[model samples]
Target: MTNWLPSLENGTGPLYIRIADEAESAIKSGTLPHGTKLPPQRDLAYDVGVTIGTISRAYALLRERGLVTGEVGRGTYVQGNSDGRVPARDPVTINYGGTRAMVPPPGKLRFDTTAAIDVGQAETVGRIMAEIASAYPGEISSYTRTLSSDWLEAGRQWLSSGNWKPEADQVLPQLGVHAGINAVVAAVSGAGDRIVCEHLTYSQVSRSANLMGRQIALVDSDQNGILPEDFERVCAREHPKAAFIMSSGQNPTLVTLPLSRRKEIVDIARKYNVWLIEDYLYGGMIDDRIPLLAELAPDRTFLLNGLSKSVAAGVRGGWVACPPHMSQRVRVTQKMVSGGLPFLLAELSARLVLSGAAGEIRSKVLTEIGEREALVRQLFAGKEFRSHPRLPFFWLKLPEPWLSGTFKQAVLDADVLIDDEDEFKPARSARVYHHVRVGFSEGRERAISTEGLKTIRRILDQSPLGTSAIV
Candidate 1:
């Protein structure tokens, strides 16, 4: 390397991201050639007037971007960029995974969101709100600093599954899983820390972490979900503060991590002392008796579940069951980050769950999902895709010559919206998979969903090339 010094001037965002952005510009401009080993972290930090930690995070960001690869002993080196993931803060690529949602266009079938199908739970929510209005008029007008014991008890009951019900004191309610995830991240990690995740997953947290000045570390995975060995490798290399996973019915991929796999992951997490955030939002809908991460490794795991997917999305209620004495840290972080849960919404959610209305509504929602899933079975029968009996979405691997992005655009042309494989990625990945997650839960009626699936199937049945109809 010929005296490579990244100019921190004229850059925006966090210091590390500015550094990474500068490095990216240099690489693209051929200033940093392929295989050129960059300056040592400490040396570069001294030269650039930033801390070693800043340089470390900047290097980590570069690796996540696939612009550079690091050796164990040697410094990070420049690599030729391939069309993988977009830069983490790119305005153009922020559309992935509904990070920024566009209101469904007229006549467009929205198979993009897994938001709970409205099961007339609003009626219950309205009723509960009215009761709270009448009974707790003073509480509604005031801020929610300390929630009631009823809220914790409601969370305990709502999040409990199979043999694993956390103690009421261990539970703290948040606005929803995303907010809870943000709080858990805030509580466990400092700025510039790495958050590890499977390459494809629910990406809202990935974006959320980046916005909060945390870096994302990608772990390689398979159809069965996140790999334990890769998780361990990332643990050792990235020193991630936390790992987020969906044990049952992982989003987008729809693969439930097996019991053995769950144990292996927990073991690796224990070995590395990495905090594990078990996002059970989707899992709460399933009756699988698989061991929870919280159950297996109670000390290091956080159990996150919400009313968003299983019951009413509008309620926006979520709960986090902490490990041992960890509740206070996460509880404070939740309050600080999300401005605490609204008093009215919190009470409403608690009343619904406490009164057993949420469960009844969830059952109805699942029944509707099952009906839609059956429709998917009948429509896309024998097609190559993964579907859960309870998951609101199906992961459909596109046929040869049909790239995911192109297919997504084609589906958009047909007025049906679905998520491309890229939507699930936290960052640009070296490995590419041509898959799309077709969510059926967003439809107001099965007839509307049928038309949407038919649209997707039509695109899938035809080729994109010479003999193709997608042209």
Candidate 2:
């Protein structure tokens, strides 16, 4: 055992953190090799002229970082040479070459990316970020490797806009809903575990499950969304570990599960003892309050919401409300997967919620989406489409002789981009629905979307002659 002594300098952030930083640096440089026993807390405290509590805190932080480990009787020992190295884990990649890759050419109309149009919220976010940066310079400049209680409360307050009032301890800030879904799935189910979702669910959820090596099971859904009987049948046969559902204004489909349907689904989940993962991505846009599955099955539910759809996708701030018993496990998995949530973004989200800016932004975005949706509804009046007025996208059920692939290609050739149903289906799902998700919020102005919609209408009305390439 070497007599370890870390220089405690003034103007450092904290005595404990400084000590931990120096210790980590030493371990990485091989000055303190693996299995090297650290000095006793009292001895190190005296040598560094700091309180024993400070040394103890430093040791605890080191242990948390996996740089050291403490034994019950013996003192702490350096774990391994991981000074500034991140944990070795395979990256989650989703190939976007099929229907998922619908990037339009420059200057072309885009009706694929489901994002809320900017309604002056960017300026508000910038101003608030500046204020937060001035007020909490250290926070913005530092890495928030852990989700603090204050941020958790901030997340809860942010969720209050959607009528989701989870307990403070139950809320955990995530990078975004996408990351939240991945973390919750990873926490509840292991690789090769059975996971179930709607037949046409969010593509990211299915992609994340595949990345985590989970087996995805798709259940049939009707116009009202996931049928309780279908869910029960799948649960009984597959015995899935969990089910992911977007209760309100589901992606691409825009179907808000009615309260009765929600209750029935919750009951089925309870009966099967399966965990329920609720994704409220469009909760802020919904005017009607549908009971969240988390509220229904708090003991076995993990609810996810984010500012990406409601506010802006670039914000990348979101929260996951987990069962009290599963909170720690979810947080751990989140940390392990993404190295913890973005503190500055979470703080920005908190400021937006606390200052009431998020609500104002949501109002502006909803108004814009409503206006666009109304125009689209009028343009496609009497057309076969399913949509919620508040949602940014809608499912346009293809007419006979017009396959999804052909329609998508026709529109793409006309300089418009849209997502087909194949992008949303699970890999093992045998069911194929011929529909395309048309988004109204991606264009810079309503006219761009209007032009794109007109082109789609024209194509739908025209005969399929000379368009064999699309087929």
Top of the candidates by TM-score? 1
Show model 1 residue runs off by greater than 4 Å: 1-100, 466-471
Report the lDDT tens digits of candidate 1 across residue range 1-471. 558898877855667668888888888777887778898877888998986656765775576466787764666778763543333345434333343246777888888989999767777788888988999888888887787999999999888889779999999988988999999999999999999988898888898898788999999888778888889999999999999888888888877888898899988988888999999998889868788888998899999999998788878998999999999999888878988788888788888898988889889889999998988888888788888778789999888767675567567667888887767888656456888999988856778888889889988887653221111
lDDT, candidates in the order shown: 0.82, 0.78
What tens digits encode model 2's per-residue C-alpha lDDT throughout 165-231? 8998899888998899899999998989989987787867787788778988888888888989989
CA error at residue 462 for candidate 1, angstroms? 1.4
Clashes of 2: 0
Highest lDDT model number: 1
For each predicted model, how many residue pairs clash, with residues at least 3 apart or on different chains?
Answer: 1, 0
Sliding window of 10 residues with minimal summed lDDT for model 2: 88-97
